[model samples]
Target: MMMVFCENSFLSYFPNGHIFQPSDASGVLLFIMTGKVLLNVFLLCVRRQNLHQSFMGYFCISLALLDLVLLVTMSFISHFQNFMLLGIRFTKYHTCLLAQITAFTYGILHYPVFFVAGLDYYFTFTQPLNSAAVCRRWLYTATVAFTWISALCYVLSLPGSAIGLDVNHYNSAYNCPFYISSQTYWFSLGMLMIMCLILILCWSEIVDTVQSVKVITYESETVLFFPYDPECSPRDCAKHLLARLLICFISTWVPFVLLQMLIVLLGAQIPAFIEMNVPWLYFVNSFLIAITYWMRRRHLKVTEETLEADPFVSWKFCLVPFRCQYIDKAQKSTSKIVMC
Candidate 1:
């Protein structure tokens, strides 16, 4: 029974000779599945309402879903890895469909996030402060609506957008996995350009905003919106550059993407022979989301602070389990899951 279950988890293609080892073990599959499940559960708990502060909720949730897709993709890869090693004949199974879903859905899902971040920054710094965050909540909903539709169009329009092809009548794949092929590189490059443009726009806005200034005459404020140094608020902006860095990562799914580009550009010869610890990149990526979400919690404003200031809230202030974000937000805001 154990071997049968193991075979299902690691694919039953391997019989006589061992082609792969613990690298594709059932244990790893369990871990990946468990971690993704837990992360997503945590996300659902926090998705109770309009995002608490600006786009952070949307940004973080999208990222979490993307990462979950990655984990699901990993499960597919691990389950089929044995086939890659010891299958009697080279085969692609229908199970490969899941991989295609992850790549295509997650691929397009990332673009809106990039555009949203750029647009967010542009509106905040470049536009009138009074008008910032003043849009209808429906506009936010519309943005998401447009995002999914556009992503569908973009993914479907891609050359060979067919998720998988029937390799043989007995087995099939959902989509072409080697997106690095010459035919698809242009599409990938085009997306890279689009995202880069967003990044550049955000960067330019940051620079322009820093150079240009407006006079501020405020009477009394409960919480300092933007934390200020003894000298000035100008100093705080410089130090919290991580804001943009976080934004860049929010939409750009480049790390896994860049790896694929290298494999394609370098060809099978190099990839086949190269013994790389590539999974480490993804592991580190998971570690990053965990830390980023945790840190974001620390920076959230209480009832007294409304400016969205305290740019870098001390993450150490949080010893609370992340689920408590709803309770800790403030008694009036305690029902944060609905708002954020």
Candidate 2:
């Protein structure tokens, strides 16, 4: 009776009743996992000095640790397949079952993790706290823990955890089935569409803004600035700067946008487990930060403190270049201005 119920649950993931052989999917998964692990390790090491200095740092370190754990678990699972473990021999079916469950859990985790990271930034900026550093650290830790626990609970509560474990049975050589999160798919699609629209709508403005922008180094940081124009009002200046920033961002992440487009056009069903990597997270992070800056553009002040928030991306360079007064002051200190 239990076997029958499990089989039915597994079959539901494939309503088409067609199970294809895994082919190179397992190899691809392993390669992706390895790359993610290496990237996370490099980031953690690079930022080790400031790993816990800010909420972003904590979030990044936590993500790195999670990626490491997943990589190790997958490696062990692959190693133990067809081997004896505590007097129990693991078959392909058992191996795929474990992989699917793990993939499902990791796949659904992206949203919650990104949400918590955003919240951390939002609260840090909006709700200025007078608490000590220790208290702040504890608060960030609790938020991170909440995201992980909530995501885990939600994944486990789903029927059969939304994984198709029967694929391996049909093809003994099949690697594993991975869950594709609809939430992630839609989120990626929405972001790509929005960026494309923004680029299209503001292409002329962006091009004009980029042409006027000058790049210079201020206090060891690259800064973008434009000469004072009598006709351009402060608001217009801000808009132009923001447009230029978007262009810069889109240029940096053009490959990611193209990949998302290709996936949509080709109807590729990339496993969420493989899609949730360091690059994807950073891409999302930059987009969220850009949105936040745009929302608060009127109130934004180009100061050294504000630029220090994001460790990975130097968004300050984009923000500081537009403030004429700031640029005037910088002109006194440096003479390395160049046109963009």
Q: Evaluated with TM-score, which candidate comes out highest?
A: 2
lDDT at 322, model 1: 23
Count backbone overlaps in model 2.
2
Please identify model 2 stretches exceeding 4 Å from their true place: 1-21, 24-29, 43-57, 80-95, 160-175, 228-238, 299-305, 321-340
Model 1 error, position 216 (Å): 29
Q: Give residue 217's error in model 1 in angstroms.
A: 29
- Candidate 2 clash pair list: 224-321, 225-321
For each candidate in the order shown, give its overall lDDT on alpha carbons: 0.36, 0.60
| Model 2: ten consecutive residues of lowest lDDT | 1-10
Q: So what's the TM-score on candidate 1? A: 0.37
Off by more than 4 A, model 1 = 1-34, 43-53, 62-92, 108-112, 124-135, 164-306, 309-340
